[model samples]
Target: MKKLILVRHAKSSWEHQVTDHERPLNERGFQDANLVSNNLNLDGLKPDLILCSDSVRTITTASIFTSNLNIDESKVIFKPELYDFTGGNLVNAIKNCDDTVGSIMLFGHNHAITSFVNTYGHIYIDNVPTCGVVVIGFLINKWKDLNKGKTIKTVFPRDLRSSIHSR
Candidate 1:
């Protein structure tokens, strides 16, 4: 099974007088990113490759999680095309990944992230919150064989909280 992990960039700061691409993560975003990493750690889900948007916020969010998780930074690849808001672009970008990668983590903006998850998954998640992480499992052995309704896991920050509460 191929695992595709989708991570939405953490909340950005509007206080900075810069373009959307240059905006950095806010304090709340930092905390939320840490929460996301912690949840992933508890879930024992690790990715072999991390494909992230070149935007500052997305980059920062990826960095925070990888650092906290003690994941090697060299595994990450920053791509400008991931900044796209449409699901088609995101799908194309994912389909282009090296097939050797068994598990991949993608960090980017939404509605692209949301649309991509909803398109491929059957779950009815209303919104993918900032720093949210969703894990989708594909049945095919190769990335080229990816298709809709192949997801096996859909994890989110709130789901983690709820699971912890129930436990």
Candidate 2:
């Protein structure tokens, strides 16, 4: 089985008047990213490969979370196509990943992320909020074999809250 984690870039700051790609993570985004990272750590889910968009906000968010998780930055790849807004583009990027990687993490924007998750995941999510992380488990043994409707696990920040509250 192949495990995939889709992470939306954290909340961004508009105070700099910069282009969307150049916008940095806001304070709330930083905290939320850390919260997501901490929650994932508590769940013992770690990625072997991290694919992130080159956009500043996405890159920063990926960096912070990986740092918090003690993951090496060298395992990350910053790709331009991941910055695209279409779900097909994101799917293609994921399909191109190395087969040896058992677990992969993708950091990008949405509606692509939301569309991809909704199209492929088993669960229905209203929205993929900033700093949201969705864990998808595919039955296929290889990354290249991934297709629509193969999700086994779908989780987000709000789900974690409910799980914690229930405990």
User: Which one wins on TM-score?
Assistant: 1
**TM-score of each candidate?**
0.89, 0.88
Tens-digit lDDT track of model 2 for 83-163: 888777799988888888988899999999988888878887778888888788787776778876555555466666677
> Model 1 over residues 57-138: C-alpha lDDT tens digits?
9999999988988889999999898889887777887888888898898999999988888888778677788888777888
Q: What local lDDT does model 1 show for residue 85? A: 88
CA lDDT of each candidate?
Answer: 0.84, 0.84
